[model samples]
Target: MPRTGEGTTVRITIGRLAEITGVPASAIRFWERHGLLPVPERRSGQRRYPPEAADRITVLRTCQQAGLTLNEIRELQEERPRRAAMIRAKIAEIEERRTALTRAQELMAHALKCSEPDIVNCPKFREEMTGWRPASD
Candidate 1:
């Protein structure tokens, strides 16, 4: 009995919601199955979702796009005992990865600009390439 923006109560079918939100129906069902989503009421044996479910799916997709695993997103979404601790841990992990990726990008940029045919042969790069092994065996 949830009211949408039109001052009237409304419910959308799973397929319609999926098309509106760009989330697959199967993924919505999977999230519900895995406890990430609330179970919807069935009208005429078809799932019907409230408007709030769209916002929840948006947040879930955003979290996944930001590199959070399903378990991590679930931890953040749930009313759990250790939510804060888990959030802190995930933030730390993401920060570490961001720092590493930044370094890698900078290295690639430098390599691309270097005039040397083989970057490893350059004096500046040679010092940094110490003990680096070739990827191919």
Candidate 2:
């Protein structure tokens, strides 16, 4: 790991980037191959990346979780202004999913506490599912 000061740039090794970013070296190489990240410079046949590159890799992982394809994320990265907007949209989508998951968890907890052996027959479960009518019905 190369330390950066106010005016200095840091050079991080592939292993260090993987350790800091929690991304495997193989995946990092794959990302580079797919054009998601620029190829790192090689020193004595060892790959090295700038410190900022690790943060970029972390952002790429977040984008992947937010349903963006690698190509789409690469395009987003190319457009600086749109990158923030895309990230914001993804954050909102993730929040909505989190809220839905919380509600689902609460319903599951309630179902588990019900006295009925069959959760499908529980009144609380029925109440929780009120608005979702079966399409086949």
Q: What is the lDDT of candidate 1?
A: 0.86
User: What would the TM-scores of all predictions be?
Assistant: 0.78, 0.74
Off by over 4 Å in 2: 1-8, 80-96, 132-137
Report lDDT (Cα) of residue 24, candidate 1.
92
Every candidate's lDDT: 0.86, 0.83
Candidate 2 pairs with clashing backbones: none
lDDT by residue for model 1 (24-122), tens: 999999999998999999989999888889999999998888788889898998889898998888789888888777767866887988999887688
Which pairs of residues collide in model 1?
A: none
lDDT of 2 by residue, 47-68 (tens): 9899888889988998888788
> How many steric clashes between backbone atoms does each model show?
0, 0
Off by over 4 Å in 1: 1-8, 124-137
